[model samples]
Target chain A: DVKVTQSSRYLVKRTGEKVFLECVQDMDHENMFWYRQDPGLGLRLIYFSYDVKMKEKGDIPEGYSVSREKKERFSLILESASTNQTSMYLCASSLGGGPNTGELFFGEGSRLTVL
Target chain B: TQLLEQSPQFLSIQEGENLTVYCNSSSVFSSLQWYRQEPGEGPVLLVTVVTGGEVKKLKRLTFQFGDARKDSSLHITAAQPGDTGLYLCALWAAGNKLTFGGGTRVLVKP
Candidate 1:
């Protein structure tokens, strides 16, 4: 079975602390994405990587950054965590092309709480 | 403003009852998809509609795309407790990305 694994299932951090969320996929997909989900806002994309070392900002990339140094690994970074950044983070991987051509497999999600 | 709007933000019904959720967008889309997210899991793709006026059925669920490509609907017949979850509608937007609606939270009681 295909799998997308998120390193942390839950995390608590102090405001202004640096944070890292790691994701790994076993499918060898070419496209990987990071999204933050909130109560009323739904899931907003933070960043997506289409290839190793290649990344693109999504609709809401304000306080977040991503690294994709390897094909199967994608990491989300919060330089200085803030209360507003507290949200459920999801990682997903998809076979090349786009959502129209294939389905996106998502990880279990990492819930981050900032104080 | 949200690119896509979903009606009936929350729904609670007894088992065996029928329910329908609507997703509307002022802007036409080339394709649309529906996803379901459970309590502690990420969203999972359920169905994708490409052609206008397309209808797809998955067991007790039925999905329909508007002929104008600006709307879609998901209907559940004889819903069970397992059907309870957050239902989201998404559209294929420019930049090869997907924009999702706020989502409809459904609760089915037995």
Candidate 2:
């Protein structure tokens, strides 16, 4: 069974505070993603990385950035958290890139509350 | 970015009942995926439909892709309490990004 582990299950941070959400995949997958799930907007991708040091912005990357310094570790960083950034954050990894890739293995999401 | 729409924002039914949810898009897709997410958990892939007019079944669940490859449907028969979750539909777009629709929240009462 492939496992994607999220470092934090829940976090509460004040506005303007810097925050870090970490994720690690044990399956040695090549593609990793960060997404924020909102009530009526669905899961909007924040960023994705296909290689260790390469990252790409997704549909909703305005308030977020990502780092993939290692093959198994991907981190989402918020330079300054705001109240509107409160949401459930999810990390996922897949085996390959492009249209023919396999299913995504997701972590138990990290719920962040910005006050 | 591809736009996908899921209908019936919420559904509630008793165990042994049947329900169906839909995902629609105007743009043709190379493939579509269905996922089920339990509370506090990330979405899990249930199935993928790649061909137009394709039909696939997993146990009591039935999935069908529209003939035009622009829509898909998930039908569950005799739904149990374990079936309660958020059902999400996603499109595998270019660059390996999965564009998702607003999910259908299903509650199956036992």
Which regions of candidate 2 are displaced past 4 Å? none
Over B1-110, each residue of candidate 2 has an lDDT whose tens digit, in order, gives: 33999988899999999999999998999889999999988999999999999999999999999999999999999999999999999987777788899899999999
Q: After superposition, how far is residue A80 of candidate 1 from its true place, in Å?
A: 0.2
Worst 10 residues of 1 chain A by lDDT: A96-105
Q: Give the 10-residue window scoring lowest on summed lDDT in candidate 1 chain B.
A: B91-100
Report the Cα lDDT for candidate 2. 0.93
Q: What TM-score does chain A reach in every model?
A: 0.97, 0.97
What's the distance in Å from true for residue A110, model 2? 0.3
Give the TM-score of each candidate: 0.98, 0.98
Candidate 2 structure quality by residue, lDDT tens digits, A13-72: 999999999999999999999999988678989999999999999988988889999999
Q: Which stretches of candidate 1 lie over 4 Å from their true place?
A: none
